[model samples]
Target: MIAQRKDDHVQLAVEQQQQHSGRNQFDDVSFVHHALAGIDRPDVRLATSFAGLSWQAPLYINAMTGGSEKTGIINRDLGIAARETGVPIASGSMSAYFKDPDCADTFSVLRKENPDGFVLANVNATASVDRARRAVDLIRADALQIHVNTVQETVMPEGDRSFSSWVPQIEKIAAGVDVPVIVKEVGFGLSRETVRLLESLGVRAADLGGRGGTDFARIENGRRPLGDYAFLHGWGQSTAACLLDAQDAPIPVLASGGVRHPLDVARALALGASGVGVSGTFLRTLLDDGVAALIARISTWLDQLAALLTLLGARTPADLSRCDLLINGELRDFCADRGIDPRPFARRSGGLDVPHEMTGSTR
Candidate 1:
């Protein structure tokens, strides 16, 4: 069963290679470019830290596939990319490993390849305290991501039905696990109320797995008789909308879902995300081109992001907070309805000064 699940995930990813609902809502976001940019290319910094660890890049490889030998190779190559780029990598749900201990190596290969690099283990929200601990142990993770895919599951023909125990189950896992716990969505973005609930349960961080990326619902629906779950195709909030809702969240927000471009990453950082996650794009890249090409692509992305930072007049990723950002179109409407002030984000660094002073010469 777990093997089939892995196969199904990979198959769906391939089949939907060119399929994106554009529901991630990134269209409504536009960055205010300051051509009076003073930052030099060398001065552009892309460093980001989370859970007490630092990485050369701000983006991490979000979860994708596991539990099968084919996926095991995928994890190996991803681990190599993480090690090469100094970015963290997360495994797909370890439920498969828990169900079949023999499959542990597939997930464990992440730790094997990137022993010193930051690694994250993932599991379902419905996981038991014991299962959570073991999942963490399975990969020697620095942190654990308990994925909450209530909607994703509802669409799957063989998905779980009972969700009443989610909160309690998550609370137990958060309290029991030795590592910091991060609650995540599978592609359907998370909201402020959900963030508040997770915070109440002691979760320190969340991945606002917003829409505008992969369509798991569509993937699951495809597995069915085509028209079974068609009515719910456009479900969930866009990644931009989800990020806006997370502004008031006490813990750090890690934006994921439909984050495909460096501009999207920049937009997410400006809104409220401490860091961003990219999965399908990276995975698809690796699949299309070998690991070396994938590594080169990540390097190009970082360079592009740094160059963008130079243009934004922000020295570092954190400095983007003080940079001018605009949320228009549907995203603005979302903030208006939610009572979130979009004006504050449109500042010369949110009124906070950048740590480094710029030279007098304007670029």
Candidate 2:
């Protein structure tokens, strides 16, 4: 039990780094401000549909916790916010709750609080199909999010190192559950090749929990003596880069990791993401100002998204995904090395607002 508490502290502390880590990798993405965007603000739609369920906004409260009684409060607060805003709320890994039946209520609280809103249940990629079904039943979740954290396992003291066998297990769970299945990278970003495999196996959506956010490597290093692993703290691909690589993927993607304000969210949407998951920011807000403050912060984030959409002349979240953006600096070089043409962006001094219609939607 003490070890669990330690794990919780380490997770919370590392997640707090999101407050300082600036998510802006590209210095040149800007929308052409439509001064004549005569559309009424209230008429703007921020609604989005993911895995067949419609959400009020594209901001989903990603998985957090369900191990102990204390976690109940955090889950409850986030669930309340989801219920109020009509967004989806995801519960943390249910493995711990499955091990200790007494802690079941810790996760069940999410469904209790948000009966009408969409709730997503989570489990490690290594869980068996039966366990995955139990986790879904525990949260009354609308979907299942299978999280893969390979590096985190390598650094974590008790983390499982043998996750290769979990692929078939994932297939079993995906086949058994009627709900949509989403495979997610815990912190390290997902590669295009890996995405292609999951698509072949019938996975519906993917979330790129990329680098530049609460690094699990740094967190694990903090809990133990640091050396080679410590040097690997900033090793993964940036969220922006990963987004570009996975933009043309077979399934829709959710841009996570290092996302802070609404501008970050808007930029992600413009980069071809169907939605943005706000986790660390919500965790910090809950810790500092309580549940009400978290809700207020989310409300502000949603409003900012609406304003950004208006500025970009996007009428809907789908439209935002099609909006054009400019790439520059190291990002431009990286894309060029991969045979992508950066000439259009280099010709422009700043970012140019390319209409999604003119550029043609990747979808």
Best by the lDDT measure: 1
Residues 20-62 of candidate 2: C-alpha lDDT, one tens digit per residue: 6463563445544545443457768998875566778888998
By TM-score, the best candidate is 1
Candidate 1, residues 1-363, lDDT tens digits: the string is 779878888888766766764445787777776556556788887888665656677888999888999999999999999999888889998889878988888899999999998899999988889998888887899999999988779998889999999999899889998899999998888889999999889897999998777778887887787548987776899888998888768778899988888888888887778788998888889988899998998878788888778888777888777777778888899899999888877765544334454445555
Q: What CA RMSD would you report for each candidate?
A: 2.8, 5.2
Candidate 2 deviant stretches above 4 angstroms: 2-15, 18-23, 26-28, 32-38, 225-228, 342-363
Query: What is the C-alpha local distance difference test score of candidate 1?
Result: 0.84
**What is the alpha-carbon lDDT of model 2 when measured against the actual structure?**
0.76
Give the Cα lDDT of each candidate.
0.84, 0.76
Q: What local lDDT does model 2 show for residue 127?
A: 85
TM-scores for candidates 1 onward, in order: 0.93, 0.89
